[model samples]
Target: MHSERASLGLQIAAIGGLLFLHLPILLIFLYAFTVEERTYQFPPPGLTTEWFAVAWNRADIWPPLYLSLKVAAVSTVLALVLGTLVAGAMARSRFFGREQISLLIILPIALPGVITGMSLRSAFAIMEIPFSVWTIILGHATFCIVIVYNNAVARMRRLSGGLMEASADLGANAFQTFRYVLLPNLGSALLAGCMLAFALSFDEVIVTTFTAGQQSTLPIWMLNELVRPRQRPVTNVVAIVVFAVTFVPILLAYYLTRGGSETAGGGK
Candidate 1:
């Protein structure tokens, strides 16, 4: 009876936590349609779609959205390439200080975002690099590389070395061995990593703020809107769009990784 009661209590606590986490998002979507302006009164007077149109028509929002997408795409590609190289070296090759290098790759991500932002800002300034889209990409890439590296490393660890050895023994060059033996195994992981990196780069604000000058991303735009209250409902519209754009890809990436995990485990 005590165990049953404890389990019931734990389940109730979990439900409460979930509701606490998502209730505000639910409220945002609900009151976004509420006809009442400015004040958030329960059971809004009426429902309206005006704010959705208003948010879509805003000229200021789209440019930032486009810029963010471009930065995210470019940065994610760069991170994937760089990260894959690092993951491959760490996972497959015996090198000096391999463990240290692996830790170094992950350190930027484990560090506080503010610290990373500050460090990037200082580096850019020291290098005489002006704040621009490139700067934002560089800043975002620091953390984004960790995502790709992690995914690639996990997949590489699960992969057997015998496959690559067999390919090489069959008279394949390094490039061909990697292409035929490793690349096929890594495809899903790389895809998942790229998607996750893109999502992170898209929504990153702190480092972008430190790196971007007179440039804004979608996340920055959202922050400005929240600070200067306009049609509050319009914020919700932006939120919904941003959430959909970012979360869908992330969810897909997660499920892709989960599939990899299952496949690897099944083979074991």
Candidate 2:
């Protein structure tokens, strides 16, 4: 009875914590449809879709959105490929500095985003590298790699090695075995990792602030709109669009992985 009570209390606490953390986001969504000019107004006065139409009509928003989407797509692909290679090497082989390699893979994500941004900025300055969309892509890839690496490593660990051995014994070459055996097992994790990386890159602002010059990604555009005097309500509309855009990809990724797991189980 004591343990059950404790567990029940813990569940309540967790729910409370989640609500607290998400309160601001909830408010953003709530106010997106608010008719009031200011957010501080009580009960939002009324609700309207004017700001949504305003946001849609704004020409300035599209450029940043396009840049962000392009960079995110490129960065996520790079992260997936590099992360999978790193994960494969670390998980499947024993070598020198293996522990160090793992640590390096995780280090960028563990450090504060500001610190990562600052370091990248300094590196670019020293190398005389110009800030552009490519720079943003590179900056985003640093932490994005960690997400992919983690997913790949976890899935690789869970996968059976006997299959690889069996493939080898059956005269399959390394590339053939990897294609037919390992790739199939890694599909779900890779898809999940790509979605996560894309989401991270899409909304990333801190590192982007340092690396981007003259180019504004969607988040950067949103930040500017937030600080600007006019179009305040329009910012909320952009926020709602961002939430929708990101949420769909995330949901698709979730369902894909779930489906993959079910298929894997059925095969078993």
Candidate 3:
């Protein structure tokens, strides 16, 4: 009887915790369809799908959405190349200060977004680099690289070094061995990392705020709209869009890596 009560208490706590975390998101969904637009009325006054159409028709939202997609794509590709190479070097070879370098590689993700944003903004000022889409991409790449590195390096460390040796013994070049052997092994992990990175870059705001001087990605647009909202329900609709955009990839990444090593990089 005591054990049954303990299990029931644990179940209740788990359900309560889930509700605490997800209740706001559920409210957002509810508000997106709300008929009353100016304020969030309790029970939302009335609910309708009209706001979804309003959000779709809004001209201002499109540019930011496109910009966010472009930055995320470029950043993910850049991270795939750089992060994988860094993971390879750090995982396969010994060098002086390798551990320190590895730590530094992952530090941007660990630091508060405000610090990273300020540091990048300062560096851009010093270098006289124009704040443009490229600057946002660079800011995003900092953390995206860490995401890919964590996943790739975790998988790479588990790789058998002997595979490379045997491939070389059979007259395979470095590129060939990697293409034929390592690529297959690392494919799912790299995909998961890229998906996670893309999702994060799409949702990013703080670093993008500093780097995107004239440009407004979707998140920035949402933040501004919240401060000075034109159609409140449209903003909720967009929130739903962002939630779907981020949640799908994260769910997929979890599925991809759950069967393998623990390489689905969560926040540090």
Candidate 4:
């Protein structure tokens, strides 16, 4: 509908925004392969594949990487189960204070990261809970659950209530109706939600900072590596890994939900 000149301007603006956001990430990729071990060089002095090998062989990196994977996996599972249940209840039911409850469910994510992190730290302190891997999982799950719940509740709201009534009339019990009817309809949404949750949990740092006492996840490891002086290229290589780990799941989630509508644009 716009004039050709206007459209060109819009396209150029969008490209510029993208470059502004992603240029730093691209810089990390460039430096990952650089030959310099200490200070960063402009137009990297040399490039090699050696950092990937170094990162692979780095003994200290593995523990944090393994912990991150484990925490993310567990947190995502928790989010999928709890978030789906909350979404189903919310989308299907009407009751007093429902809006308030909905706000509370989303509050963890709506709050600033620092606020959430501080509250979690304080809660753990009051409860006399020692910081550990489980604490990290709990912290990550708070936000991860919100992501899954947003996806699931949106999808659930779009589904026809008549489908459930029809299932009931067909002599299916609640469990059978859910298994045969709801699960199939909600499958892609749940998968997409879980993928998003996993990616978020895998890279979360602020909440992890409060919850991970004496332990390090991959992000925490990267933060520490940045502060200290070691083979900086190896840290960049790990950053590339972290980026890939988060980016792939997020990209997959986008694809899974791109057609989330029952009708075109129905769930947008």
Query: Of the candidates shown, which would achieve the greatest TM-score relative to the real structure?
Result: 3
State the lDDT of candidate 1 residue by residue for 156-229, as single tens digits: 99998898889888999999988888999899989988888888888888878888878989999888988887
Ten-residue stretch with the least lDDT total in model 2: 259-268
Off by over 4 Å in 1: 1-6, 259-268
What do the candidate models score in CA lDDT, each in turn? 0.83, 0.83, 0.90, 0.87
Model 3, runs deviating above 4 Å: 1-7
Per-residue lDDT tens digits for candidate 4, residues 1-268, read 8555557889999999999998888999999999988899888989899989888998999999999999999999999999999998899889999999888887887888889889989999999999888999988888888788888888889889999999999999999999999999888888888888888889999889988999999999999988895999999999999999989987777887786552211221
Superior candidate under lDDT, 3 versus 4: 3
Q: Could you estimate the TM-score for every candidate?
A: 0.91, 0.89, 0.94, 0.93
Ranked by lDDT, top first: 3, 4, 1, 2
Residue pairs clashing in model 4 are: none
Question: Residue-wise lDDT of candidate 2 within 1-268, one digit each (tens)?
Answer: 5454557889999999999988888888777788877555757888887888888899998999999899999999999999999999987789989999888987887888898899989999999998977889888888888888877887888788898999999999999999999999888888878887898889889888988988899999988877764656788788887887778767766676564332211110
Clashing pairs in 1: none
Model 4 scores a C-alpha lDDT of: 0.87
Q: What is the C-alpha RMSD of each candidate to the true structure, in Å?
A: 3.8, 4.3, 2.3, 2.7
Quote the positional error of residue 66 for candidate 1 in Å: 0.5
